[model samples]
Target: MLRELPRIFVNIAGYRDTELPWTIKDLFEKARHPERVFAGICRQYAPGEDDDAAPDGVFAEQCRVYDVHAKDSLGVCWARHQTQKLWRGEEYAFQIDSHMRFVVDWDEVLLDMLGECDSARPVLTTYPVPYTPPDKLDSPVLPVMFARFFDNDDIVSFGSRISLPEDAPEKPQPSAFVAAGFLFGPSKLIADVPYDPRIYFQGEETNLAVRLWTHGWDFFTPNKVVCYHDFSKRPERPRHWEDKVDWRRLNTVSKTRLHHLLGMEKNGDPEALKGIENFGLGARRTLAEYEAFSGIDYKRRLINGKPGRIADLPAGSPERKADRKRRFTFIKESNGWGCEETASGGGSTMAQTEAIRRDLPGVFDSLNIRILGDAGCGDLNWISHITGGLQAYLGFDIVDSLINEAREKFYDRRNHFFSQVDIVIDALPECDAIICRDCLTHLDHQEILPALKLFKESGSRYLFATTHFLGKNTEIKTGGWFPIDLTAAPFNLPKPLITISEEAPNSTKSLGAWKISDLL
Candidate 1:
């Protein structure tokens, strides 16, 4: 009894490339088990002009082709989506451009590298080393994705740079972005996160990376070079945008669909985005979790190299756990939290804070709370409008700048005070009730208990904090984001004495009031 070799489904989207034939030849010639390698091509070419694009002999027999007129082609992603439809229940999915050269035993190399990843669902992807025409490949250096710039359409575009030999990790390194040209992962990725045919071109990689991550697929770049992409072919090749007349209209609609899917466009017309629900983000994780893991903030159009959360490390590895704690400590030493003047983030926006704004004052009066403490008050955005009746209002935040600005802005109001405090370890002031909104969700699991203990040690009788009624509580790195349910297992907090709905559009978020002792 012998074990069978895994089947690999190779997806190539050819848009009038003359190199397609040679690419197929190289693919078959370099694989150790050629019989297990299956190619699926979406060939977009003019009727009589691209006879060479078709596979010949053994290549033809092993491949499945879907032909389309080059003029009718939507875009690369559209063609890739069509190519995915030809999959025949293979074990792995390997996607690459039509013009590529391969290393010897590249299929086996990729499978071996993927096996080294710590995650159960690992996706290996990167921009391949570039090659010139015929047979010339550039120096064999790994290319890793980086946030290049924000395009005019407000979507983040990624660029790649050679990983320095001294800096590149020995194993596959955790990656935050995906390369559309080269991606290799399990066949389950095809079923769980299929490419959106509606996306035209620009937002394809970001869209795929986000959806794959949210669906519980971890990404890593290969430690060894497996293939070379023809970078010089683009100038000579015929692109879909050049051949199609309505390319602009198609691109616009595609970008809008991407924006809505990423939650960047909260006010977009629902009628214009009819079928986007079928291609939205996954339920295993939230968009906010992706933003925290990757430092690319979609809403703010900002890319900070400082990562908030580290990827999941293996459990019971004491050194790795210590390193994780050190990485989180580095964040606090480098800088305090950031907040915008009008809105801090999704949690603190005016729209999401409306319900709490309308109900907090009445609740304060009912509790007979004259002295109030605001734990983790960020920039005093909407909270300033609700503090009219308090005899004294004290605001605390980790960021010194926000605290200083708050003091200067309300200098005329004698009863208002601001101070910088670290809620996890610092001593807290005595107040009737402590309002800790939009704070606990950002702390690491280990830190949350200490923060709760600190709050309990404070003389405050009542605690009002943000809690999500929907979804199970998930852990994140120190500066990350997630909808934390206080009543869940880890916290085991009792039901709130009173709940004020935040009216969040995506989830059931509310300001839940609890006794400080119940939080621990």
Candidate 2:
């Protein structure tokens, strides 16, 4: 049985009957998880007017609701409720907007995540918003959305879209930062770092995050965990309110204040505080005050440590540029055709050329010949058509009526002929060399393994083939095969003696080749 750990205490603020998508009663009915204990502090506009009915109906006698509202007592009431919850020794606490929905098994996710960290460390989690992108508006209501900005517990950087680094491993890593809407941490941590009442709304998270980061708290976001927020469900307001309040300005102010408190601003120069200013109000003030308090001159620091601009740094620094260079070399070596218009297309053509080129030197030196698939409309067969004097044979699979008619009318049966194409282990011919270009990608995954096995058993001394490497979100085309595995192996049998080239081509006809033997 899974261990029943400490329960999660959720503090939902600003939740009202009309503001919620459905009544809070309906929301909790779906959230009736046995492991979690629910408690709500609903503020009422009038005294002795109990709003406890909502929690009573939703929790079904499982939780408690307190009506702590009085005249001008909103902030104090929330503070008191938070204090009381902490006093009760709740293990984990979250302050959330009422409209957010829980999609995943939070208990299992949190348990698995927390187990990966030290017990002494703090826990902070953010929900993924599912409805941010306009394109998704037409789709079914998804439970998660992609965040465009980068988030860290200490600092929130907006505007830039997130992407994996070029050198990133196959799997994604934990993010260094995250937003606060769905923040999480140990109950004691929250108790120790109480929200500063001075912050009405804007800079509260910024201030808290700066303090946490300064104190050496490790912060991260799980790559896969997600949640959805109902941004559209917020209370309606009067027109021109956006211009009057200038929420963006408020954000700038809070960010500036937090930066100031964290001592991030050292000098009067604005560049040091640019990120904050760009974010909005609290940011500028925070940096200004932080500079004043820390007595760290920003101008002096800037002069002492001049960070290089991104453009000035060597291309793709922090990762060796060799991989890209290797890819280019392979392209130039492989592609013999030069007709393509773009560098990438040209490179691809060259890569194909190089694959044949590598084997050419050995074959020419030995005065031996090789055979490739027949010269049909398929581009690869052109090699056999062009090399008139070379001892190369063309093998055609003319099953289609149109192709058979074209073949019969075109008068070239002397050099090329249709043959039975079989991929089983027993049907292939023993040869000194063979080539199968751009054919693997058309086979099914099931056919690939067996075909490779048969190729190995063909007794061919050398074989060459072109296959694809898997990329993100790539799908198999209808009636086409996706590669089973890209790695060279006994699975990719009858492996060629010569190096396979995978490079960008320059054109339709000229594939450059570099002998790996030359590198030796």
Candidate 3:
């Protein structure tokens, strides 16, 4: 008896993309078993206006396209759902965007990579390296996705880093997240964990990754580049957001539904979250198990420090301690942390710093903060906007150059002063409130407690600082970045006396007011 070769069902969601026909051609030409390969594309195009070309010729016999007018199309997830409905029980399913270039024998490559995985069931996915149209690749390397940070919506934004020496250990590596642009897995995913059409755009990967993991499916990244994706969005290509006037409302509803599904919020739009129970988590694995493996606490909206990567040594490590002490000095001299407008991060931008600007003045007045100690002050871009009423604004930072520059720039305000001081080691000047923002996030897990202790002992009546509301306080190297949830375990901080949203509309970033005595 002869064994039958496995068949693959390629699921494509194309919207006004002119490269769809070429992508299909490349896929068929590059596959080892083009005859056995099948495709289901949900082509969302403006019938008479779109530049998209249909896939025809010999490959058309093996491919199916479900046409939906671009103006009527809801979003990518909706189109992908339509594509899933076209699945014809193939042995495997490969999901990809409409613009892509494939390697020769890519089907064989994916099958081999899948075989190399240790899991009984594995899905290969990644943010493939970018390629210019008409075939241009720049030393394509295997890439792995990592958690960049939680955005204002508390959504997990991802960042990709290249995995070097692509030739080594020609096996799939375990991944905590999935890429929506390219995912290849068992055909059962179509029936077991179908794409939720209600999810519009932003949180598609996160939603799919969680549901797949809970359904007993493991994720891995291909060790070698199997395909190249066109990452650049051409201005000519029409997008749903650009065409639809209500895109913002659709996105909000989608995020609300996702927030409910992830257990982040109990209450959301009833209409949007309706029928979500049908797409709830699978019984094969609990959501908690998925969280444990992925290092993402869904309810808390926290990401573990080392999801899959190694961290610097523990807080007690002499090297880490030394690095913590010298980090700011080096950053100032070397301009290590780059920002165009302000040397501080994007959080220090005008829009991001709006919360502090709008609410801090009121808090200062309420607390009668006559002498304000601005610890870890960088550039004084945002804070400079609100230093008028204070009797004394003493800005302290480890960066000597910043202090010198600040001293020169704000010389007109005799009440305003700049000094070089390390709050962790140096004695802080007495003040009514010690305003520390955007500092603790970069410190080691253990260093934060001592810094907090120093702040309390400084005789500052109130501590106004940045407190990430929905994140796990993960251990990290002293100078590395991670959100700090002061109320969570280890920190065990009591509720803040007054909490002002630093970033609004479900954003976890906030400035919390804590009476120094309460911190005791």
Candidate 4:
């Protein structure tokens, strides 16, 4: 790796312990270009007669060491300062935790993987597979993790224990979040987006991911394991958070400021930051595009990534499992149709939802549709169906609270309107085409045909609805979740222009394509 890049600037910060010395020495020795290592360290060694002294003059001009007193208590504050101080003329830079085990030629592995990147700006990072001390068992075979957003915007990753895909993981499979412990990228990227000195440690990854993404850069993990991290925290070793006066409050404030910086609403937009001192987002992409690509809605604190927990929902019993085909539908469901923060949907809208999501975007691409309404009755996947090229998009839900939240979250979108409108009570304004899917099943038996007629009147010639034939279930419980049969109604029921039952994967729910003229 030292051969690949001319010089490497190493920033060793925070109360460094005894192992940091051995780790630093190994870094220089193992490298093909040890002369290229320019380490800037800030440390306070524990007092002891047997403790080794600083190797300041020993390495000559190679390393620059700073001895901060043990009482100084320098936490992540050393990140920006030490990096700037140590940054010599280097082509690339990497930020890694001191307590890590690197494979032989790990530097070469990282540099080669990073060089394979097709992008001008690239980052290779992951929460590396773990390793134990020499006394324990060998490291387990683990694949490169494809991560998902876990509880409360935190990240939890999972991958097969078997065959791992060997390819350019970044461009093909972008990361939803990055590991702060192992971030590798270009030197200019690090300089352009420096670590926020004001930022506490808790939400560092979240802040970095957003700032980097908006700045037109991307992150990916290498195909193979280059390093292993020992997560075992030693009780004898002191921690910075343990010393902070009130770290919880400080962390909350940092995350809150992040909310304002990223244009999210969970923290209620303390102040919409134009740009903070020397740090802020670039003009490469919108946060919404990032949210769509990542399946994360920051304002709602919801994660809906492609391979996220939402997609990895648990399967059913053997008999039920065979019929279950994993499907994705992009319906902007209304409020109260809550999603499990840890899992996807409840196995209802898979087939139809995904079908509409995959197809409807193309519908607009071909036909010059004027408007689309993703009524507030289903999932928020519809938002991903479109980002541009639409004249206007009316995204509404039945619940007022969801509408308000969606308002704040999607406020940056142009011609993307949201409101709380019950189609049963208030008529949805007319549009060139209307998309209402996976929601009709939840209405009362008497309310189905009227809603169909309303959609037909509003959309004119084009309409798309994912429906269940009441003919299949043959049962009606007044107002329930199950679909009530429309054909068997006592009175003359309003019929769709053309209703054709089609089989699909994922859900047992059948799909039907509708046209307003055929139904009316």
Residue-wise lDDT of candidate 4 within 160-237, one digit each (tens)? 233344433443245656777677777777677777755656557777787888888888756656666556644445
Predictions ranked by TM-score, top down? 3, 1, 4, 2
Residue 104 Cα positional deviation in candidate 1, in Å, after optimal superposition = 0.3
lDDT of each: 0.80, 0.40, 0.81, 0.56
- The candidate scoring highest on TM-score is 3
Task: Quote the RMSD, in angstroms, for model 4.
Answer: 20.2
Q: Each prediction's TM-score against the native?
A: 0.58, 0.39, 0.60, 0.51
Candidate 1 off by > 4 Å: 1-3, 164-168, 269-272, 305-520
How accurate locally is residue 113 in candidate 4, as Cα lDDT from 0 to 100?
82
Error of 2 at 261 (Å): 1.8
Q: lDDT for model 2, on a 0 to 1 scale?
A: 0.40
The sequence of per-residue lDDT tens digits that candidate 1 reaches over residues 419-442 is 977776677877888998988887
Model 2 segments beyond 4 Å from truth? 1-4, 15-32, 40-56, 60-87, 117-120, 131-178, 233-260, 264-520
Error of 1 at 97 (Å): 0.6
Tens-digit per-residue lDDT, 220-272, candidate 3: 98887899999874647767766665666778889998888788898988888
TM-score of 4: 0.51
- Note the residue pairs that clash in candidate 1: none
Report how far residue 61 has shifted in candidate 2, in Å: 4.7
Candidate 2 per-residue lDDT, tens place, 465-512, comes to 554332211234212334433333424322224433444354122112
